[model samples]
Target chain A: MNKIFEVPLYAYERSSDQDAATAVRHKVIVIGAGPVGLATAIDLAQQGVEVVVLDDNDKVSFGSRAICFSQRTLDIADRLGAGSPMVDKGVQWNVGKVFFDNRQVYEFNLQPDTGYANPAFINLQQYYFENALVDRVRQLQAAGAPIEIRGRNKVEAIGTHDSHVVLEVETPEGPYNVEADWLIACDGANSPTRRMLGLDFDGRVFEDNFLIADVVMEADFPTERWFWFDPPFNRGQSALLHKQPDNVWRIDLQLGWDIDKEREKRPENVIPRLKAMLGEDVDFDLEWVSIYTFQCRRMERFRHGRVLFAGDSAHQVSPFGAMGANSGIQDADNLCWKLKLVLDGKAPEILLDSYSRERVQAADANIAKSSRSTDFITPKSQISRLLRDAVLDLSEHFEFARPLVNSGRLSTPCTYQDSSLSSADALNGPDITRPGSACPDAPLGDEFLLPKLAGKFTLLTIDAGAPERIEEGGVEATRLALSVKDDLTLELKRRYLGDATGAVYLIRPDQHVAARRDTFEENAFRQAIRRATGKE
Target chain B: MADLILTPNLDSADDFYAGLLAAHDGLDKSASDALNARLVLVLANHIGDADVLTQAVKAAALRGS
Candidate 1:
C-alpha cells in the first residue's frame, strides 16, 4: 500500500461552531473535500467569498483513482495556484497505442496543434492531486483567505429554503447545525447529499465490470497508454495499462458480468492474472485492487433553489476516457466566477442558470463520447461486436479503419457554441478559438497568454486598439494588448487571427471566448461584457 | 443531395461479384459474416460521402424489407 493513503491529511479537530448555541450562517458551504469540492472552496476563497468544505473522511482518497488529468484541468489548477505541484509530480505522456488480439493495431500522439504551458495529459495518482489541492487550501488559510475545511464533518441531512440552506452535520464529537446562503455539493457519485435531496441520477449503467489493480514493480514498459483488445491473457476482454508516480502501474482488466466481484478482487485471483500478463518471472507487489462498473449519467439539472451540484454528484462517465475528474474540475472552473458575482450582488441569480445550461451541454458531450467509447470497447450485441472487430482487423493494415477503432476518445474541453452568454462572432477568426471556445494558449515573450488572463475578465487585443478598462453593468474587463510583431512564432496569429490583420476578443473570467470583432467598438464591447456577465 | 449510384456504374459487375465470392469461398458462416462486414467498412471508407452512404443504406434496407 502507498504511504500517502495511510496518513490523515485533514484529521478531525474541534471547532467553535460545535460549541455555539445557534447555527452559524456561512456565505458558502461545500460538501465533500474531493478535487471538485476543494477546488470550489479555493476558487471561492480566492475571490474573497467565505467558503467552508465538509468531508466525511480526513484523508485523501485511498487508491490511485482518476489518474489522467487533461491540459484544461492543469490550466484551471494553475489559475487556482495549485498546478505546479501536480505538474511536477505527474507522469506526462501523449502517446497511446491500441492492440487487437495481442497484435498492435495503431498508435496516436495527442500533441496539441500549438505550444501549451501544460502537457496534453498527465498520469498522477488521485491522492497526489487531492493532497496538492489540500496544500493550496492550507496556503490560502495562512494568507488569511476566508476558507475552512472541516474533517470528518458529514452532512447527515439538508434542508433547502428560498434563500438559505440548512445542513445537519455530524462530527466525531457530536452533531451540529449550520446554515449557508448557498450550498455546493461536490460529494461524488453515490452522493449522500444527493440522496438527502431525493434528486434522480438517471442514465445508462453498463453491465460489464472492470478490475483495477495498481501494482508496484520495476518494469521496462515505456510511459505511455497501452490498451489491449482481447489479449491472450484476458481472452475476449479488453485491458488498459498506464504508468504513475512511485513505480505504480495502473492496470485495468475487463471482468465480464456474472462473476463474484469479491472473489475476483482477491489477491489469490488477481495475482495469477497479473502473472499471466506480466510473465511468471516478473516480481511485483499489489498496492490496490477493486472492481467498478461505470455509468454515463448526470442529473437533469445541476442547480436547485439555493443548492447546486458539481462534479460526480451531478454527472458521471465511464472511466475509460478519464472524464470523471477532469470534467469535475472544469465544473468548478465554470461555476466559481458566476457564483462570486451572484454572492456579491454584481449579477442576477439567473447568471447561475447559464452555468447549468453550459455545463449540462458539456456533460452531455462527455456522456455521448464516453458511451460511444464504452460501446466500442464492450459491444452489447452480436452485430455490434462483429462491426467492432472488423474495424480492429482492418485497422491493423489500413489507415482509414484506424480512426474507427476507438479504444477511448480522450477527454477535451467542450466549447459552448450556443451559450446565451456568448455574443455572435463578427471576426472571422480560427474556429478553434471562436466565440464560446476556450482560449488556446500562445507563447508571449517568455510567458504564456492563459496565465495572464487568469481569474478575471480580459479583453485580448492583437494589433487592435481598445480601452485599458471597460466596465458595464457592475462587471469590468481590462485590456491585455499584444501586437503581432511580438509573436515571433506567429502561433498567436494562426490561432486567434486567420486572415484578419487585427482582432479584439472579450474573454470570460474562465478564459472562454465570449465575443470577438475586427475592431473594438466601445458600445459593442460594453454590450458583450453585459451579455457575458448575464446582465443582458 | 447526392444519391447512391444505383445505375450501371460498374462495368465489370459480374467479375467483381465472382472475386468477392472467391474471397469468401473457404470461410465458415461466422468468418463469412466477418468478411462481409469488413468489405462494407472498406467500401464505405472509399465512398466517404455521408449522403451517399445514407442513401445506400436506405436502398439496402428497403430491399431487405
Candidate 2:
C-alpha cells in the first residue's frame, strides 16, 4: 500500500570481485526471490544451512499475481515464520462457484472439515506474500541465520561441474563471478539457468491467452471464487472473478487465440468487458492489467548433478487451479530438508535424487490436473465441448457428475504413492493419514499435528511406550506418546492408527509418512531413516 | 499401470448384467454389436490408461478362445 505502481530500483552494495580465481564460494545459491526460492532459502536457513538468494529484480512483483494461497502452502509458510501475517493481510476464502453460461452449475467449499488453524485458502496479493517472506528472512538473519537475499543481483551465465556449479552474476555495479556447492535454479518460466544448460519443458502448450485485470472498487462482492464457462458477460468464452485483500478484484477474461493481444489489453476493451461482467453502474478504477498464455509442462529432471530446479524453473502450469505456486512451495519444502541433510553429510547424495523424483511426480500430478481443468474450461474439440456441456447439465441435478465438472480442481498436496521414502507397510491403516500422504492436520491438545511433527523425524506412538530418541548415524528422532484416553489423541488414533491398539509411525522432516508399524520392532526406526534417506 | 479388476468393483454385478442383457434382448446381432462397440469406447476413454485398456482389449479378444 505504501508504494502504488512505482517500480523502484534496488540498491545493493557491489560485492563483485573482479578476480575470477578468488570468487567466494557459497554452500547453496538460490536464484529467484519469488515464493519458491524464498521458501527454500527460509527452510534451509531455519535448518542452519548457509543459503543465499539471488533475484534479478529489486522491487516486489507489481501485480496481484498468484492470489490464491492453498492451506498446504500456508502450513509451509507458517513453518517459515510468515503464516500469521499472511493470514492477517490476506482475504480468506474457501467456497467456489462454477457457472455454466448464465446459470450456476457447481459450488464447493474446499474445506468442510474445520478446526485447523489456517483456512482452506487465502486470497493474498503476491507482493504482500513476498514482503512477509522478506521480513521473516530479515528477522532470521538478525537472529544469526546465514541467509542472504541479494536483489538486483542478476545471474548472467552458469557453469555446472561435478564438484561445484559456477554462476556469473550481473549487478548495477558490474558483472562478477561466484560459485556454489549447489545452485538452486528458481529463476522462473524463462529460466536462464535451464536455458543455459539446454533444457526444454515436455508437456501441453496451451493456445489461448488470458487477459488478467485487477480493478479497485468499493462494490460488495462475496469472498468466493466465481468462475464462468461461456459467461453471459463475454459470450462463448470463460471468465473468472476473485476478490483480493485490498478492495482490488482480479478478473481474468479468456481471450481466444484469434484476438489481438494489444487490442485486448487496452483499457477501452477491458473496461467494456468488466462493465458487462459487473453492470455499468458500478464505478471502479483499473489497478493493473496483463496478458498471459501458459503451458502445462515441466523439465523431465529437476535435479542435474550439482544444479537443481524448483518452482517455475522446473515446471509451468495453467492458472485455472492455482497449482503452480503451491506446488512450487511444496518443491521447496520437499527439497530443503533433503538438501540440508546432504549438505550436513547426514544422508547420501542419492537423497537429493528423491527431491527430483518426488517433485517431478508432484509436477506431473499438477500438470495433469491443471491441464484437464484448462481443457474443461476451454474445450479444444467439438466433442470435448459437447461433453463438457453435458457434464454441466448433469451436474445440476446429479451428485455423481459434480466431481467430474472441472473448473480447476484447486490444488491439493500431491501424495507420493510410489515415493522411495515411503516405507512398504503390509499392515493396513486409515487412508486419511497413511503412508506417502502429508500428515493430516488434527486439532492436537494445544497445537496441530503438522506443526508438532515438522522439522524432525517424529515417531507418533498410540497407546504404547514410545522409543527413546535415538540420535545415531547423523539422524535425530523424537518420539511422542499418545493415549486413547485423551480426546485429541483419540481423534489422532481414529484418523491415523484406525483400530490398531499399539502402533508406531515414522514421520519425515517434511511431515511425510516414512513408515508405519503395528508392533515396535527393533532397529525399525533407524532402518526407516536409512530407507527414507535412500542409504539402505 | 491400472488396478487389475478386483472383487466388489460394482455394488450389484447381477443387476447390472441383468440390465445389460435386457437392453439387448430384442435387438438384432448387428445393433447389439454396435452398442457393445460404443460401450467399449466410452469405458476405454473413462479408464484413460492406454496400457491397461490395450491389455483389456487383448483379454476380451482371447476370452473363451
Q: Against the hidden reference, what TM-scores do the models get?
A: 0.96, 0.87
Computed on C-alpha atoms, the DockQ of candidate 1 is 0.88
> Candidate 2 - CAPRI tier?
incorrect
Which predicted model would earn the best DockQ?
Answer: 1
lDDT of each: 0.90, 0.82
lDDT of 2 by residue, A294-334 (tens): 76688989999999999998999888788988989999989
**What would the per-residue lDDT of candidate 2 be over residues B1-65, giving only the tens digit for each residue?**
77547356888999999998998998996567655644554576578787888777777778563
TM-score attained by chain A of model 1: 0.97
When summed lDDT is taken over every stretch of 10 residues in candidate 1 chain A, the lowest stretch is: A107-116
Winning model by lDDT: 1
TM-score of candidate 1 versus the correct structure, residues matched by position: 0.96
**What is residue A196's positional error in candidate 2, in angstroms?**
1.3
**Per-residue accuracy of model 1 over A180-233 as CA lDDT, tens digit each:** 999999999898988999998997655468899899888676778888998888
User: Interface root-mean-square deviation for each candidate?
Assistant: 0.3, 7.2
Residue B20's C-alpha lDDT in candidate 1? 89
